[model samples]
Target chain A: TQLLEQSPQFLSIQEGENLTVYCNSSSVFSSLQWYRQEPGEGPVLLVTVVTGGEVKKLKRLTFQFGDARKDSSLHITAAQTGDTGLYLCAGERAGGFKTIFGAGTRLFVKA
Target chain B: SAVISQKPSRDICQRGTSLTIQCQVDSQVTMMFWYRQQPGQSLTLIATANQGSEATYESGFVIDKFPISRPNLTFSTLTVSNMSPEDSSIYLCSVHGGQGNTGELFFGEGSRLTVL
Candidate 1:
């Protein structure tokens, strides 16, 4: 089975603090995606990183893909209360449409 | 953007009972996905709902416990049978990819169920 492991399962920081989450795997992926989910709601897509070494920025969040397509990371700059959520990373296999997800990183940004 | 909605946004059910959740997508989508999230956990894929075809379930899941249906491209339903306390979770429906069909996926608000 292909597994994606997320580090630092829990994080809490005051407003304006910075944090980074990592997702690593032993298998290569055709594409990788990041999502943030709030309480009582489904996950919302943050970014999709397909190519190795690719990076995408959305407001205060920056997502990066590993050079080997086996890992990804999400960095939050000047975190806020609105950034408090569970961050997830999912990867799609090359020859199939099936996807695998990491355990997750729960971030709490207190104001 | 393809907007997806799941019925019974939240429900409290008794043990041994069953509940069927409905998912509706505003636009025609090629792939409709079902996921389950336990408290403080990441989403786990239950199955892939295909139009006019039988749903393909993943390992650790059984067809008898979770029966799925997709009669058309824009609609699908998932039924959980013989509910137990452990069955309580948030069920979400997601559409794979958007316009031009990148690897991105769009999700519904989700159905939250608590089995008492």
Candidate 2:
């Protein structure tokens, strides 16, 4: 049983504040993906990090995969009100048949 | 990227009744998955619907309670039988496109069920 644990289950920050969320797991994964889900909508893929020590950026959002492939992080710089959403981290097994998701961090950025 | 659509976007049903949700994809996909998301919780994989075989359910999930049907490459259905209030949640249909399992999954606007 593989599980990914996420931190800061809830967060509320003023506009222009920066924040970082983390996802850690005891098991190794072949690839990790980040997703953002707003209210009343399914999660949308933000980025995918396939290699250990890999980093991918989408606009002001940055994602990093740990060197051991057991952890990952998402950093938002100068966060805006639009960045408010539930951020989820998912890890895919080597065969890509099984994927496990983290609990997710719900961020609320006030304007 | 594939576009996915789910029918009965939101439904309020009485307890002990059944609800069948339909998922349609614009293009053929290699894999289709069903997930349940409890309020303020993460997505839990319920089962993997194979194109021609019986759906493979994850641990804690059984085929009898949540039966799945995948008749072709682009369509699937999930029926929640004998529902209860605890069963009220968002059900999402996801698909993996591209060749040979190289692509990420695309999700449909989930079907939200509220059992009263």
Compute the lDDT for candidate 1.
0.90
lDDT tens digits, residue span A47-72, model 2: 88888999998999999999999999
Q: Which regions of candidate 1 are displaced past 4 Å?
A: none
Query: Each prediction's Cα RMSD?
Result: 1.3, 1.4
What lDDT score goes with residue B84 in model 2? 98
Question: Which 10 consecutive positions of candidate 2 chain A have the poorest summed lDDT?
Answer: A91-100
* Chain B of candidate 2 vs. true chain B, TM: 0.95
Best by DockQ: 1
Q: Give the clashing pairs for model 1.
A: none
- Which 10 successive residues of model 1 chain A have the least lDDT summed? A91-100
- Put down candidate 1 lDDT per residue, B9-102, tens digits, no spaces: 9999999999999999999977799999988888899999988778899988988999998989999999989999999999999988766556
Candidate 2, after superposition: displacement of residue A19 in Å?
0.4
